[model samples]
Target: MLISHFLHGPVSAYPRDYVDGAHQELHQHREAQLLYAVCGTMRVVTAQGAWVIPPTRAVWIPPLVEHEIFMSGEVRMRSLFIAAELSPPSLQQCCVLAVTPLLRELILRAVQGPQHAENPLIQSLMLEEIAGLENLPLHIPMPEDRRLQGICLALLRTPDHPNTLEDWAQQVGASSRTLARLFQQQLKMNFNAWRQQLRLMEALPRLLAGESVQSVARDLGYGSARAFSAMFRRLLGENPREYLNALNKLSELNPLL
Candidate 1:
């Protein structure tokens, strides 16, 4: 059985832990939900495919689609469920949005306020903030090949390990040329692209845990924080520090934090 917190309106906030191997399935509500990861990570699987939601980002669930969320760590989720009529059409689709300072604060404030049906002002502010969600290009792709999956798991286990495709290929008993070809064919991306996605995924959890940008960069095998920041801006259109600061402000506004 699935557990849920019911609010007076279309919103809810609570902590959750899933121990059963069964995925947490929810047939989409009539409202859009902004799911923020207060702690730990959530793996969201939908018809569009699966995406890992680390702490630094939130996943937006639009109305009426079946989705399953799996937890990797203890999860504290602050879920903002908005009425269908009040939400933006764009948010009607499931996607991961980069939470901004203002939007995050708005959510925090809304969560702290009374969950009365009469609170139209809070509801309006929630809708406005939902409209402001910025789509991010940074996303993790599911690996198809068993060998490639093995390689990725190895890399994730040792992110700081400086190893090229050739090194990984040697360990996997495949040539670098073959591994590169398989990555492009199965993952629909090249080696560097896959590596960048993995790095970004790893960076999110660290950043959310309050690690400094320099520390995260170094941990992810980047030579300097500046280089890491440049890649972050190029991919997600924001600096690492700016993203963390926005989350910090959100935490400040939320009494639960």
Candidate 2:
């Protein structure tokens, strides 16, 4: 359903909690949204792609974009609904944003006070912070072609499925060459790259839940932790342990985010 928020100002903040396995059905609002997971993890799915929001990260959703949120564990979500006019032109599409400490604090402050009548100073600071946020490479683009969509959906259900493009092509009734072409044209990546991204995205929540690196790697069908670590470092610029360490450091500094 399309929901319209009657905001008293340009920005309004909201806080909510969700338990493990909770799902927010597909919905959209008139205002652009900054969906932040202060704790736990959230997977935000939209028409174009899916983005994983862990602690210290948020998804910037442009107005009128249909989406759904899936919680991996207990989630404390802090949301900011900003009027469409206040949304930055450059951020017309949904993407994950790196939430800095200041931005996180601004969000908390906004939500702690009266939600309807937002403080002008905090609203100004929050918008400024949002405009300068760095976009993270946490999105996995979904394909539109029916053949590719079928294959992608099946793989998402089982990320560890060790199916080559040739294998998927046979299963989907398309030639391997044609499937490769569609992957490049639609997702801007080869099949292997896309699958790797999907695996990593799926791995994040489990890792945050205290699953060991070796366990996650084995569960994801990696031959060894070394192979998984190499892939993680190559794509995310850090090993799994290092990535978790950074997030832990942030938590130690401030438990709020």
Q: List TM-score per model, in order.
A: 0.64, 0.93
Q: Model 2 Cα displacement at 162 (Å)?
A: 1.2
lDDT of 2 at 252: 64
> For residues 54-147, what per-residue lDDT tens digits would candidate 2 score against the true structure?
7779999999999999998888898999999999888988988989889888887777757423778888988998999998778899999999
**Candidate 2 — which residues are off by over 4 angstroms?**
115-117, 253-257
Candidate 2, residue 139: lDDT: 83
Number of the top candidate by lDDT?
2
lDDT of 1 by residue, 1-257 (tens): 23334465655543344442336765556556678766567767765545666554688877656778877655666677655565687775667887776666655555564653236765666667667878765555657677888887777687666888999898889999999999888778887877787788778766776689999999889999999999888887779888667666544554454
Among these predictions, the greatest TM-score belongs to 2
